[model samples]
Structures are given as structure tokens and as C-alpha cells.
Target: MRPAGKQPLQSLYFDYPLFEFRQPPELHGGDMQHPVVIAGAGPVGLTAALALAQQGVASVVVEKKDTVNDGSRAICVSRHSFETLQQLGAVAAFLDKALGWTRGRCYYRDQLIHRLEMPHSEDERFLPMYNIQQQYIEQFLIDKTADYPDLIELRWQSEVSELKNSADGVSLGINTPEGSYSLRGNYLLAADGARSTVRELLGLRLQGDNLPGNYVIADVRMAHEFPTERRSFFESSGNPDATVLVHRQPDNIWRVDWQILPGDDPDDAVRENNVRERVAAILAMIGHEGEWELEWWSIYTANTLCLDNYRHGRVLFIGDSGHIVPIFGVRGLNNGIADAVNAAWKLACVLKRLAPASLLDSYSPERRGATIDVLRNAGKSSRFMTPPTRGYALMRKAVLELALTQEFTRPFADPRQVQPYNYEDSPLTTPEAGAGEFTSGPAPGAPLHNCRLDEDDYLLDHIGHSFTVLYFSIEARPSSELAALFAQLYQLDPACCILRITGAADQVNEDDVLVDASGRISRAYDAIAGTVYLVRPDRYVAGRWKSANPEEILAALRRALGGSKP
Candidate 1:
């Protein structure tokens, strides 16, 4: 992937405006009622608020802190995440400041073992992933909230102290700098990070595997010419029987994660001196001898955990509050972003009365399924990066040895990265009649690819935040049934839209149409004339029909909105 529209940027934390703690009128006196009350202002909560705002839904964001995150929390934003940000109106700032990369190299004992290239093509707008600090991720989201002043309100230094869930709504007791307050919402979103107060109040517990291997992640600054790429070192002379990972970030900073020997205290590992020593050893091993300064450091053990359910009455959990997967493939925040997107759209539909309450029930299964899928892949990467047992360590050593010499073994060194999960079995999706099994292009429950629809924007810009009927009609004129189908969508979802795409300009009519002059959208969908695709508000294909039938589309729309097809 190639970087585009590169511009110099200052520190995201320093350059962006700091949010101030707004004094709320004693909510205990019943001063405010938010339709949606979100519990956290981190990346997940901020993204959830923005997603709600984009869908014309109002929300209140409660942050325990007055500023964005101060560390390089999550540095890799996947391509699908970029699309979601685009839908939520926060991608331009991210692209301007992030380091986009597609290639990674794996080394076993100083010998190149494998070179991995993620799926990237010139046709795509954003790179497969971008490396930016979590501070920027939160800052960009905060900045975008300004565009929807009426829709999103951020409450800084406000912590959720208590939560009461009922059939009608959820009431929250909040703690602020000024005084204690109370608030109520029709629905509550729990995005308060891994130590979620909402989850505690709901009495929900996460269950998953916990590995004993520990790792120390440090962010250091230095001037060097190494391009942006992920490099993993296995059992190097600098750290025998341990693995170190090097990832480049913006602002001349790099993220270094290395395994800590058993019985090493995590407190001692994050000490500046200990971190500097480890950085020096890895830097020397990687052939760098620059004067380096340690910026920040943290430590953690490998654990994969998730709640039994994501939704509880009027309260819903999102992001890390709902699940925690090993960070082997950068699935942590990326999956959290997916959570924000998924929950936001469904909440919008139910809030707008466009779907049944059962629609929101699918959020748990679909996203939890996604979390489990991530665990399955990330578990593999974790076992390789930090073997949990002696037998696993021996197997990894043997695998590394084979990868060093055998080309066939190199693919095992892949980090897999983050991919949008297929929701073929989602209750909200029509059962796939072999559509999800397709290898050529998108299947039902697959992600919609961005393609140049005209000289100005991509096809994805036309989809999202509402049900979309993408009817592939090559002719300039629309048929009566197509027009009827378009009309029906408005009745079903007021936010819904129909993108009438055609390769011929002469066939375009008064209904605003998109000209797929390059035929990329058609190729990406493998569509023909009269083919129709139903896209959910979250940009996943709900169903595809060889022909546009209004009744069939209406039935599919019902199923997508959590109603059984009649």
C-alpha cells in the first residue's frame, strides 16, 4: 500500500484542542435526559458516539478523563476501520497523520524467514492499515464531534458510578468534579474499557483462556531510515528464547514489544532503565545504533476474554467492555471499532422505530462471534509469539527452525492481521445459499469494498448509516420495479438510499445516479444488469438477488431489521 496526501503534523495530543469538563446542572434534580448514554470516552466510546451522530441519533459521552489517551495504546487501524471512520466522518484527519503500511518481514535468529503482504490494491482508497497512536484516534473522533454539535455531547471528567437497568430505560449515577448527579437514557452503552463499571453493575463476567506469558510494550523515539513495516525477531542473540516485535509509528516514534522472562516483575519491566536496556538490545539486534529516548512503556499478560452476552436490557456493552482478545494481530482496538459500528447502527434502527427490539439482540451473537473468530486467529499468533507451555515453546522453536530454511513453513509466521468477519450465520442476515462461500467477490454478510464511482468520491461514500439498495442497472433509465423498490426503502427506513449506478451517462435520469465509469463497483460485486444488493446500515451486504424484486427486497429488509420474512 502507498501513502497519499501526506502532510506534516504536530503531536496529536498537543495540536488538538483539549476538551473541558462541562459542569452539568444537578442531574440528581432531573436536569437532563439523554436518549443514549455512553459510559466511556475512549476510542470505542468515542467511535460509538460518532457512529450514532452519523446516523442522526443523539448521544451523551461520559469520560472519566479530561483529555484523550496519552500513550500509544492501539497503533494499527485496519482498512475496514477506516471505512467505518469515513462513514462516521473522521478519516481525513486520521489519514493525514497516520503511517500506512502493508508489508511485514519476519526474522528467525537474524535470518529473514518470511515476507508478508496484506491484501492491498490501488483500487482501494485507504491502505490495508495505518499506524497512528491511540491519542490521535481519540483526538480525531473528538474533533469530528464538533461537526455534530447537537448530536454528540461529551462530558469530561464524568465517571459512571452506578447503573440501574429496567425495561423502560437505564438510570445512571454519575460522579463529577463538581458534585454527584443522576441521568437516564432509553438505552445505555458500556464502552468504559476493560474495567467497565457498567459490566460490574450488570454482573456480567468475561470467560476465556488466559495464557501465562507476559510482554513489555514500550514506545521509544529515535531518528532512523527504516521504512514502516512490522518486523518480528524470534530468539535473537539479544534475547534468547524470547521474541521482539518492532512497529513504526508516526512522529519518529516506534513501538517495541518483547516477551519478559518468567518470574520477572511487571513493575520492574516497565521501569525506564529496564525498558531502555531492552530497547537498546533490540535496536542493536535490528542493526540500529541511534540515540534513543524512552517515551512510555507498559506490560501485560496474554488473555482472551468475553462476556456471555453483549446486551443486557436497556444497557449494551461495546468494545473492550464486552470482549478482550490477545493483541497478537492488532485485533484489540480494531475489533472494538467494529463493535462501535455494529452497535451504533442497530441502536439507530431500534431507536428510530425502524426495526424491532429483536434486531438489537443479534448484536451479541454477531459481534461475539466476531470476537471468538478473532480469538481463534489471535490465539494461534499468541502461541507462536509467546509460547505458554514447554511443549508449545518446543513446537514454536521447531516451526521457527523450519521457517528459516523451508519456504513452505514461512506462511506460518503470518500475523494474519485483522479482517472483517463474515456474518453468514447472523440472525439478521438471510441464510446464505452458498453466497458466503464465494471466492471471487463479496458474499452475503461480507464487507462492501470501496471503488471509484465517479471523479470525486468512492462507492462506499454512498453506503452506510442506513439501509442501502445498490441496484446495478447499466441502462440510463430505471425500470418501474426498480423505482418501486426505491420508494419502498424510504417507507422502510427514512435514512435508506438507493444508489442507481450505471456505466452509461445517457441512461442516467433525474434520480441522482452514480456513474461507475471504471466498472470497478460492478467488478467488485460481480454484478450484472438488474442485479441488486441490500446493504445494512453497518455496510455489510444483507442479501443479493440476481434480479430486483420489490417483494423479495421488502422481505429481505424485514429480515435485516430483525423481523422474520413473511
Candidate 2:
């Protein structure tokens, strides 16, 4: 195990910066109090800090390590994750550095049997997936936090020794390079990874089963002409009776994984020479004749473990600390990103006194429900990729065999990719209107569809860090009642936004209105005259109506805020 110290870890293709750890004011008895103190300076923790900062909340992030993680772990980022990053003002660097792709190919016995194409449209701002190393992910998030120095304080080599929870707040005993000190936070966010110290100290345990089969994941640097697409091989000559997955990443670093046969010695699977031989065979099978050097390697098994609840009084768990999803659908990091965003926004509302404390009670249900959904889909992929029983193994073989001759069976090879989890059942979501009220659009608790408004503008681009209302008007000018409703909305919450969409191009001169000259945005949202959609701060639709009344809109807003008393 790596020791807890300020030593900068080495990476083959990435430079590691030695972050300086300064003594905290608490060590000098200065009695510093943080609004939110985040544990574990990983991608999720840093993302939570950034998301909080975006909501005008301050946080202090503590880490036991000195720099970014060593290996290229969690290399896949989904488009939904990029949208979260966009809200935090940190998507530019990622968009510039990550390799985006949407195509995947699956082969049975070296013969291509299935091709997977993820959903992509011209209205979308990002592709389906982006391949970037985790080290770069952490570093990019850290760099983005620099824009909010007052809001985010990163402390390296600081480890939590003890935690005390109270109704008022949380007291954390932190050990640093200098010495041990204590800090108080109104709330603590545990973004720690699989082996969570907070969960242990709190005497909480994750509940679920760890699936079977171990796979050796390795990264190699080589000059290859492969495009950035996923390739899966089943029963290949390189690794018979097992599955092999390959992905092309930036910096000429390719990630490869092959399952370890049941009878094979798991220890020998990762041995330097054995890994080299296996990688060489796989490369040859893929028709690559170029030389490659091993960078890093590790072993992992599929697991669907998760905590029953994410909130523990003052400490709210996010990321792997709360749940660990299988990597088959690339839901691990992407789901963590979603958790951070969801919790951060609700925490911000509570801290700013915009909503009651009960507002946070909905976090566990929404995110944990999403985790459960991931487990269901990922379990299927896991069983197919690495069968735990002979029955499952035979079933997989039969499916592969049938897929070779039967075109209709090819769909069985599909690795169901991750999708944005809908919070339709969330307590915070206002009940939607009757099903037939609207023909097409995002239902309550669904994420807003990104629609193109012009050559350079999209619907989500106009969103700010607050509750949003989209009002579709048939008249070139809003009626007096609608104007009064807008006034009432501002009076209720000045931070709330009322975006008026009109077909009249000349009416676009208004600051709060968007001109649907092409009607594409309207069509995408299924917006008709007098249609109203209320969106939460996290971009999920809170409620929608065919014709909205001021009282109904205010009531829905209050309900979305956990039925807070106005």
C-alpha cells in the first residue's frame, strides 16, 4: 500500500507536480470554520468542491496524497458528466484534452458480429464518451478550482483521523505533515473512494454482492493508428474462453483488459512477463505489429456494493464512498459525478437559507436510486462478460454461437452503455401532469434536452446556476397575466429565471427571450403556446404544465425545494 505522505507519484506519460501543503489556521488555534469540508481529493471530491463553488459556497478539501493518482484509472467520461462540468465552468480543458468517440465494435472469435453506435445528434454539444486518464481528470479539476480560491481550499497530506457528528455540524480531527489539528464544518462531504475512512469511522457498511471473475487491466504506451473506438473480443485466439476489451486513449496510451481464466493462477496474471506475453498476443490478434511498453497494471472484479443510505447526519457520502458500480457500462465515475452535482446543489440551497434543511433528505433517495438502476444494468453486463456459474457460461457461449449465424441474436452482444438517470420518483420532483397532457418532452425529473437555438447557441447554454422556467408564448408579446406572473416570480425569488421563447424573430430583442427562428428548440422540447417547464438547479425538470398559473408555478417551486414554507 502507498504510504500517506507528500511524495509525488510518478507516471509514465504524465508529469506529476509536487503540491505544496501549507499549515492550516486551525493548527495555530485560529478556530477556522468551513461551510463544507470535503474528504478525499479525487475526481468526485474535487468535482463536488467545484460544484459547490459554482453555487457560491465555500469548501475545504483534504487529501492524504501529495499529487494526482498514479495510474490511468476511470478513463471514460460520459456526455452527461461533461454537462455537469460545464455547469462548474471546468469543461473547456476536458473538451480540449479528452478523446471523444461514439462507435464500438464487438467480435466473436475474431469475427465482427456486432457494431454499437451510441446516441449522437447535431443538437448535442458533446459526443457520447470521452477517453482521458484519471490523473488528468483530477489535475484538471484541481486547476479549475483555482478560479475560486476563496471558495475552495485544497490541503495536501491532510488525513482525517477522527470524526464527530452533531446536529449543529461535524468536527474532524485531521493529521497533517505538520501535526494534528481540528476543524469544524457545518456539513462534511465524504467523496472518499472504495476504502472509505469516514464510512468506517461512522460504522457504516456497504450492502451488496461482489460478482465473480477477476480481470487484469493494463495500460501501454505505443504508436498505433487505431481510432478512438471501443473494441471487445469474445473467445479470441489471444485469450481463449475469456473476454478482451481495448480502448485508445490520449498520449498514445492504450488501455487493455482481459479476464483471467478460472484455473489460471490469479497472481501470475499480473506478473510483468506474463502481462507482456498476454498483451503481445492480443496486439498480434488485433493485427498490430508495433512495439509497446507497459506503463501500469492492476486487477479488479465486478461488484455492486452500496450503502442503503448516502446521508449520515452531517456527513453526506458521494462517489465510491457510497456505492461502487461495475465498470462494464462506465457508470462508476459518471455516476459519482452525478452524485456530487446533486448533493452540492441541494447543500447550497440549504446553506444559503433558500430552502429548509429537509431539502437534503432527498439526496439519498435520488442518488441511491440511480445507483440501484446502475447495478441492475451493470449486473447483466458483468454476467455476460464473466460468467460466475457454469449455467451462465453456457448461456454466454450459446448466445455468442447463435450470434455468429443468426443476425437477430447480435443484439445480445450489446454492452448497455450508461444513460442519465431520471429522478422521476424523487421526493423533490413535483408530480407531472397527466400523461396525455403533453405529446413529447422531458417528463418531470428528467434532464432537459439540449436543443440547438442557432449555429452557436443551445438551450442549456442559456441556463444559469438557479431555478429556471421556460415559457413558450404564441403571441409576439406576452399577455398582461403572463407579465404579472413573471413579476410574481421575481418577487418570490430574484435568482429564479424566466426564459421566454417566441417564434417572432423581432421579439428576440428582449434580454429574457430566445427567438426560435428555426423552431428547432421548440420542436425538441415539444413546446406549444402557453407551455411552461420548470427546471431545478441541477437541470432536471421539476414540473411542466400546458398553461401555468402564478400560484401553481410558485407551489411547484416550493415543492421542488422540499416543500419549504414560504
Candidate 3:
């Protein structure tokens, strides 16, 4: 089936659009600089550009490739990612074509041993995971960039050859199809892949361990009736002594990842006949005897590598350029998207002079902390999926064998799906006044839980791309003094949204307020009269309070913005 928002120009599961590369003006005239220059046009870079545009920040995105990604790489999209996409105005395009699923099953020796169900409720707008090709993800983000033509300039087939950075700005030597040109920007964000050219130019190296185990991910087309759910197999008859993962994608394509044993040659694993034999064994073992054709396949190794620092001078590294995590937990693309959002918002605030330049310093710490956390958890999953030593292998085998009969051992088979990182230790997070009092709501540095307002409307729909204040008003309208306080906060930052949640629909007629008629949102946020939550631009709660004190809220906002002068 063709993806939404684009016409099919090719005959495969999706169309690959070849973007045209235009001549640069620097070839014939003087150099031109941009507010921000982004390297690479992959999903991460494009998402950064879109996120920047959401804040009215302009950027120039350069890509070495002329078309989208070649294969169905990085097919899993997390709900937190969907929330970021919604802020960038590109979620509808994704929801149109991506397959959503919440359930996963694990099998050991062809026997079902464990099941995984990510947290989901009717109040949530998106599912736990969505399966779609990376090409579609890139194309959808590219399509959204068209809406901000004046802000985003996409340069295709233009690669970064030389780079120089200083405290003031960054300069790059860009090589295009026509010739070479020099460009400048106040800041450079590197969203390029793991083998980033910018990272190399900056002489930064990724520091981490590359866990042992080689897996070949292959996508095949067939008319299988299996539902869209993640399924993992351990020590199955298909491969005898390997771990395999199966995921159903759109357009009737199935993605199968089977491990290659230690003595197996990585090159020979992708041979047509070898792949066919292994795939046939896997399909037969899973009771799928239908005819299938191989579409694409690639070799992947589990690694947890990242840079010590994400920022160098005026150049900031994001996505894979900043860190690389194990693929076992589907943290690659999702983590990159998170990096893009985090960097874009902070950079935008700095550029707009809304916050001090020190705000950018927090990027490396927050994101690097997240990377370290992923490495820790994914290291466990990687070792579990592919035991490195003989003793570990034996332990894993015993766990699987015992898991078939013991209920407690069954949890050992769980993959421990990826979850959003809490930035409680972040410098921007303000300690709550009565933090110990609230037991149910999102704490400082945690993401707000979405609440369903109606069948179609959700809490996230009301969130904006700025600091938001969720004020709970018990009366029909806030006191005159509290109303004056809201006006004062608005005067501090016009972009700031002070959304008053009233208990009754007729309490307020202002468009800036939300009516919690059903009290679902109140319960979700654990709100009472005068309770206030200060939400950052990235949707993470910065601070919350039981009483809506004006000075405390102002201090929290300033602290969240790097203590900038009001």
C-alpha cells in the first residue's frame, strides 16, 4: 500500500523520491550564512529542522544523499516519539500509515514463555509502538518542512567536507554536485549517522563497548495473516542456537532478525541461498508456510557507543552522532528523535534570546545521561539476547528452560521495553515545595501523562511549544489576585500559556483555559484547588506546587530557562 501524503511513483511497497540538488549561490556570489546549519538529512536532522521551525527558528539542512533511506531500517516508533512529532505537526501523517501495536510475545524452544504489554489506556492518543519504514518517516518529516519554506532550506547531495567552529559561530565547506561552497551559521547541529563526518572533523571519538553478536535483519514480502505484534524466539528449531525477532510491518512485509553464531561468516550470512534457507526454517517453525520473497537485508551489531561530550565549540552533536545504543531495545531511532527535540528546543530558546547561552550547556549532560541509562539497560538486554561468554550462555539457557514451567522465571524473558528518561537530576528541574505530598502525578523532570478530554481530543492537544502552566481553579473563575498573577506571567513571556482548568464547563469562556468537566485530567494530574504545574517546552514538568504562589512559579520559570533575567 502507498504511504499517506505522497503519490506512488515506484512499484515497491513505497516510493523513493529523488530530491533535486540546485546550484548554490556562493558559487557565483558571496557567502551566505544561516541562523542554524544542520548536517545530514536523515530522520534526526529533518526532525531537528521541523522542531526548530516550530519555534520560529530557521535552519539549513544538508544531506549527502539524494533520496530517502534504502531499506526498512528503524521501523519501530515509540509513543513518546509520537508526542514529539505532534509538536512538530507531523504526527497525523505518521498515524495515517504506521501500524500500531501494544502486545508482544516471547517464545523459548518454540514454547510461549512470556508476554509484553506496554502501558496503554483509552486516554492515550498514540500506542506504545508504531511500525513503519525509515523512508516513510523521513518523507513525512520532509513533507512537513514544506510548510515552513522560509525557515527550512533543504540541500540534497551536499556533503560537509571541512568544518571549523569557534565560540561565536561555525563555518563549513560544503561540497555539492556542482562545486564547493562555504557556509556559516551561528550554531551547527550534527544529526548525521554514527559515522558522522562532522564528528570526525571535530576529532571526537565515541567511547563505549561494542557487545558481541551479529544479527542479520531481513525484510520479506508475503500475504501472512499474523497480527502486528513483536515476537521473539530463543533457541528455536529454526536456527537451533540463536535468538530471533519477528515484527510485522505495513504493506504485508515481515521483518525477521536472526542471530549469526560465532563461527558463522558475516558475509556468507547474507547470501541469497543462506538467507532463504534460514528464513524458510524460521517461517516453518512459526507455522507460516506461505510463499515469501526477500526485499532487503542488512547486518547489525549491538553496541553502546557515544561521545564523552555532545558539544564542541559552536557545533552540537545530536542523534547517532551523539550516541549509539544497542538495537535489541529499539532505542536507536527513538532515542535520536528525543535528542533532536531536546537540542532544537534549547537552541531555539538560546537563539531567540529567551534564555542565556548557558542553556545549551545542559544539552550534553541531559542527553548524555539518557544515553548512559540506555547503555546500562540495553547492555543487559544485549547480553540476554546474545550471551557473550560460555557461562552467560549456560545461564541464559537455564533461565529459558526453567521459564517454561516457573512463573517467576518467565519475567526473565522480558525485553524490558524502552521508556522515557526522567531528568530529575537535570539542572533545569526545580525542586518542588511539597514534592513529598503529591503521590500520583508526574514529579519534577517527568513527562506529563496524557488524559483524554473526549473521544477525539486529548490533553496533549492543548499543550503548546512554550512554557505551560496548568492551573487548577476550584471556583468558576480564579480570584482577582490570581487572575492578575496569570496576566503578570503572560506579560513575562507572551509565548507562555497559563491554561486554567476549571471544574465546570461554564466556569470560563476564555480560549486560554481548559474545562475539566469530567475531572479525568484533574485526577490524572492529581490536582486540587490552587495546584500548579510548570511544564517545559519539551512537555516535561519542571516544577509543581500545591499552592499557586506567584513568586515560586516565576522562580521556577527562570530556573528552567537557565536563570535568565526576566
TM-score of each: 0.94, 0.96, 0.96
Count of clashing residue pairs in every prediction: 2, 0, 0
Better of 1 and 3 by lDDT: 3
lDDT tens readout by residue for model 3, 1-566: 12233243443576678899988676677777788999999999999999899889999999999999888889999999999999778999999999999999999989999988888999899999999989899999999999999999999999999998987899999898899989899999999898999999998899989889999998888888878999999989887889999999888989999999988999899776788889999999988877887777788888889999998878889899988888977888988988888889889888988888898888889989989999999999999998999988999999899999888888777887778989899999988776477878899999988899887888888998888999898675678877787777676566888788878787556777788899998898888889999998889999998878888888888788888533
Angstrom error of the Cα, residue 444, model 2: value is: 0.4
Error of 3 at 287 (Å): 1.4
Superposition TM-score, candidate 2 onto the true structure: 0.96
Backbone clashes in model 3:
0
lDDT of 1 by residue, 27-133 (tens): 43646667899999889998989888888899998888877776786899999999888887788899899999999999998889999899987668888989999
Give residue 188's lDDT in candidate 3 (0 to 100).
Answer: 97
lDDT of 2 by residue, 287-318 (tens): 88988877887888889999999999989999
Compared with the true structure, all predictions reach lDDT values of 0.83, 0.89, 0.88
Candidate 3 scores a C-alpha RMSD against the true structure in Å of: 3.2
